[model samples]
Target: MKKYLKNYIWVILFVIFSIGSYFIGFKPGLVIYSNFNEFFLEMISFIPFLFIIIGLFDVWVPKEALEKHIGKESGVKGIFLVILLAMLQAGPLYGAFPVAYILCKKGASVRNIFIYLGAFSSMKLPMLGIEIGYLGIKFTVLRTLIALPLFILVGYMMEKIVGSNFKVEEVKT
Candidate 1:
């Protein structure tokens, strides 16, 4: 029942938004027509693969095993790992949530979750080539490098302030 309701939610949202959009009577024709394929393509391309990777990670990387790498003690090493992990990822925020969800479930620390999301949000190395092509290597690298420390800091602060409810609760010794 919960699962059915969850799936129904999106359909409901789509209907509401479509109806609202029509009544809003704005010039959405071009915006919707021009972008629908791109949006659909992105969803099809990213979401399934993201789910598979997350499922695989959950299966392969046991909670006890992950403690060595991403636990609280890992600190800066964990931050770097998160950055690399984020850099390797592609697609939208939804693409990354499955991994984040599993990480939280697997005893990954709250601070690390913040770092992981921050790192993932900040480091788009997969798109660096496009960024460089459109802008320049120096520009892309400089921006990312500058943002790196800030992202880590933000992650740290967020973990401290938001507390750990954002992730699965684990007993702290």
Candidate 2:
């Protein structure tokens, strides 16, 4: 019970907040309810499919295959591969979490996982296309050019700070 409460403290707080919002006024409560409903709908529509896909990937893709391309010793090729995978992926940032966990378990380096996550957060291909449509080709290209290198740099820096040999141990939840 203590562990469950510890893990879900924020959720409990959110429920309290929602109740307080209702007591304060119907409008505030409705707004919160509507937002949560929309988010829940989106998660149901998208996240389950992503989870299924990741599950299949975990089952079918050999760990050795992942390590060959994104392992600690894979060097520049690994970096490029991670970036490519990240850009191609479509969905919310939260969707990448499970994928990253799988990759870590499959022997992908900490640096590469960080790079993959950075690219997922910043350079998703569909979002990039939308950005180009609204922000123009030059702005989108410039941002991508700038952000990619920066993300790589951040990944390397994090790896150094955390320890060059660090790898994620399997986290049993």
Candidate 3:
């Protein structure tokens, strides 16, 4: 009960502020109320979709399969594995959380996970397709070619430097 209350404290505060604002004839506060309500509703609406996809991924993909292909010991194959995983990833950057959690538990290398997510966030198929559509193949390819090494370097630095200090319980960013 305490945990639940703590988790929902913001929601409670928002409701109180909203009701108080509405009764006090505060127009700006009402604008905030409406905006917060719309954002909250939209966020809530995606929960089911996120759960369905995560659950399916958990059920379909085996731990051994991921470990063999994307494990810490995969050597040079890890790069290809990360790219493949990134290519197959779905949703926006935040959507990687569920898969990341699963992969972490399943012996996926933290280093590879970093690279894969970096690639997913930057060079996702959907993003690439959109870029190609808006710009040109040359631009898309050039952008990707440039971004690839940067993302890889970022991933490596994240692993060697940031990983040492990071706590698994809270989000880093």
Which candidate tops lDDT? 2
Clash pairs for candidate 2: none
Once fitted onto the true fold, the runs of candidate 3 whose alpha carbons sit more than 4 angstroms away are 1-67, 164-173
**What do the candidate models score in CA lDDT, each in turn?**
0.67, 0.79, 0.73
lDDT ranking, best first: 2, 3, 1
Off by over 4 Å in 2: 1-68, 165-173
Off by more than 4 A, model 1: 1-68, 164-173
Q: TM-score order of candidates, best first?
A: 2, 3, 1
Give, for candidate 1, the lowest lDDT window spanning 10 residues.
Answer: 59-68
Local accuracy of candidate 3 as per-residue lDDT tens digits, 28-88: 9899999988877865665556557556765676634544577667766887777666765
For every candidate, C-alpha RMSD to the true structure in Å: 8.2, 7.6, 7.8
Tell me how candidate 3 scores on lDDT: 0.73
lDDT of 1 by residue, 71-98 (tens): 6667778767666666666667656667
106 in model 1: Cα distance from truth in Å? 1.8
For every model in order, what is the number of clashing pairs?
0, 0, 0
Question: Under the 3 Å rule for N, CA and C atoms, how many clashes does model 2 have?
Answer: 0
Clashes of 1: 0
- Cα error, residue 49 of model 3, in Å, equals 23
| Candidate with more favorable, higher TM-score: 1 or 3 | 3
Q: Please state the error at residue 121 of candidate 1 in Å.
A: 2.0
